[model samples]
Target: MLPWIFIGLALFFGVFWFSGNAANILIIYVIGLTGMGVFLVLTSLTISKQSNLLKKAFETEKNYPPLLVKAILLFAGIGMLFGSIRYWQDVPFYQDQNFSVISGKPSSIDEYNSKGTVTELYVEIKGHTFVLDADMPQFPKYKKYEELLDKHFTILYLPNSNWIIDYKVE
Candidate 1:
């Protein structure tokens, strides 16, 4: 059960690292770090007094040494820190001043199909094209591709990735 909890935490962070918004990532990073710190401090204070209680609470036959728990926490903390740093590096590019705006109804909306499933959505507005994928931050906002057709939309996007940073239906 202890190992399963750690595995679930790892997978949660892995998915969040790829698809989470920059602001959300930062918030989670802070919260996760703070929670880990508090847990370590509390555990250190009570481990000797409640070692048996802790073992029984976990309901596992095997005991997890304090060192192993600390190691796992350290590893998770490092992974969150790395992901936060990487997301922060791209924050400046998503700022309002860095984004290019296009205001008009989309001329064409294309969905790329792979194995009978839509893998990518491409929207052409004015003369520029923007690509959206499930993993992208902006994909959820424009997910209903058919609704976007012939509807006037003001989109702010990064020029390099052509990923929408913001959009307004007008």
Candidate 2:
């Protein structure tokens, strides 16, 4: 039981550590490897004694398949499915993202501006210069952009560079 608790904690931390960021390729790769490792570990640990115990418990209608096991299995299945789909579909994480919302082009930042505490950035996507405003509708506060925002957000670019909303400090 203690070993199982330790293993569960390790797994939780492992997944949490990899939760953020946009390295889709690297994330997929690491998770794939880690998942295989976990599966192998679990399989090796499931000895004949454990199987017999489970069978007997099941036959007696005892509580052998604990909630922990069910939860772990559920999470593992979901994670594997999500990772495989992301890899196969080439889903872009927030950091690896290079898409320009303004011109619908692939490009990098060209210039940026800051006025009084407000900031704006411009990136030439495809071949057009789209404004990046910290207060744009596509910003985190923008309802239209909620689904677009993933867990990690450092690489996000906002357009309409001059639309800064100001509030009184008092």
Identify the candidate with maximal TM-score.
Answer: 1
Question: How do all models score by TM-score?
Answer: 0.38, 0.29
Q: Tens-digit lDDT track for model 1 on 1-170?
A: 34345445555554544444443344344345444443433334333432555566676545575445645555655555554454345456765357678889889888888998777777788889876554545454445578778578688775654546666665
Predicted candidate 2 versus true structure: per-residue lDDT over 14-56, tens digit per residue: 5633551223234444455356445534533443334545466
Which stretches of candidate 1 lie above 4 Å from their native place?
1-91, 95-97, 114-119, 134-148
Pairs that collide in candidate 1 are none
Q: Residue-pair clashes per candidate, as listed?
A: 0, 8
Candidate 2 segments exceeding 4 Å error:
1-13, 16-75, 78-82, 88-170
Native-referenced Cα lDDT, model 1: 0.57
